[model samples]
Target: MSKNVPGIMRQKPITPWLYLVPSLIVMFTFIVYPGVNTFYLSLRNADNTAWASTACKAGESCWGIFENYHYAITSEIMQTAFLNNIKWILIMVTGTVALGLLIAVLADRVRYESVAKSLIFLPMAISFVGAGVIWKFMYNYESGTNQIGLLNAIITALGGQPVSWLTEPQINTIALIVVGIWMWTGFCMTILAAGLRGVPEEILEAARVDGANEWMVFWKIMIPQILPTITVVITTMVINVLKIFDIVYVMTGGNYGTEVIANRLYTEMYKSYQPGRASAIAVVLILVIIPAMIMNIRRFNEQEATR
Candidate 1:
């Protein structure tokens, strides 16, 4: 038995890999294969023709290497779409984290904390497409004596002009961002609230004894202790902001300067039948998401290591 111990240890090592085989197969089939195919397709011309092709599709005969990329970057609509994605990252990420933290902090001390959190977190339960549809009706414009849109109705009641919430570029992006914040703030709040709960009550009592004011307790003790949770929330929001599609698509169909990277990719691949350009956009989106995902994974590992 002692002499056979080494062989048993070797068997254990192989068993883990054997157990991983199914998961590895699934990842390769669903993720790795599609990813490689997308990159290869991105390098080809619009008509799916490689250098060996005798001819191209009728309208895309002129397509060549670098042609789709050039058009994707140079097109005015594409430029606007890229810009809109940037704006979303800036506004949505900041707004969601800030508002979520604020709500979490305030509600943590309230008598009806559970009720307050449940109300705030309700939007997170709804799908993004459903939220977009609901908001769309709320922003509907009509040239009439009365308006159903919440904002327009409020403006008219105040004897002010009704603004086109979704039609104008400047306001449309912000309006869409409001929807994102509404949907995600609850998620942030929930995570932060859990972190808040983990905070040692004894430590807070000690801070109070040390002459620390409520504000000081929050800034010095509460925030520092919850820093890890805050990082997790912000990174998660950043990833979501990068991949935002449903709201922009359902609300505007990438029109009126509300276009985003995902929307552009969908349009290029499906509507325009330009697989190469769409793939390029997809690759870019992946590149943007990879860093955020890495940060999240590292944070998670660090939390586990601490535990």
Candidate 2:
């Protein structure tokens, strides 16, 4: 046993690294290498066969070596995509978190709790593309005919004109965000429900005993205790909304002012065959997402330390 101890000690450090070799190789090949390559491509031309033009004639409009990034920042389609993504981040994130928390709290008091939760979470089981397709039917518009879309049918039934839910630039983005909220609210509810379960029952009871109303108990004691969970949910929602693509693509094809960053990136890469602009868009997305990811990690670390 004594002789074996020296040999075991020698192997211990290397043993963990040996286990990590496969994952390291995979990460470098897929994540790190692609990330670096994308950055390199962003500096090149549409086909990535040459460096982007940096020279300009006196009268010509040009963006120099960063032409791709210039297009991403200033082009009309990219601008629309950026604004729409910002709207998504604000509205979709808030709606999901708010509705999810409300439903979680209310469901806890209901007799059929499991049934309610199951129904709410049902949408999450469907893929985003599937959900988008289902809702597209719900939002479909056909003029000079009987309303085929459920929403339009309801409006016509109530003596209102049929509304174009997926088009007409003013309301289109809002229309798409509604689908996002519907799909993700269930997820937020499930996570928050778990956090709610961790609140100390004794603390809640004591608050009530001290003349705290139900609202007071929820606002003061319960909310603070579960705040970290709420933070996690909010950050998760933000990240998801930032990369929103499938729903926009399936439902709107990014038409009628519904363009989002990811969809625009797809359009540049595949349809326009502009690899450089697509790569620049991807890099921009990563930069935007990193801060949220870092915040989430720090929050998680704090929770672990407390544990």
- The candidate maximizing TM-score is 2
Q: What TM-score quantifies how close candidate 1 is to the native fold? A: 0.91
Model 1 clash pairs are none
- Candidate 1 segments whose C-alpha is farther than 4 A from its true place: 1-14, 51-66, 72-74
lDDT minimum window of 10 residues, candidate 1: 51-60
Model 2: lDDT to the true structure = 0.91
Q: TM-score each candidate.
A: 0.91, 0.95
**Candidate 2 lDDT tens digits, 165-233:** 888899989999999999999999999999999998999999999999999999998899999989989
Worst 10 residues of 2 by lDDT: 52-61
Q: Model 1 over residues 1-307: C-alpha lDDT tens digits? A: 6676786465654788998999999999999999999878777767876631322346653445555555567768878887887898888888888888889989977999999999999999999999999999889787864898887898889998888899997799999999999999899989988898888999999999999999999999989998988998888888888889999999998888899888999999999887888987888789879999999999988988988
True-structure RMSD for candidate 1? 3.4
- What is the lDDT, from 0 to 100, of the residue 37 in candidate 1? 93
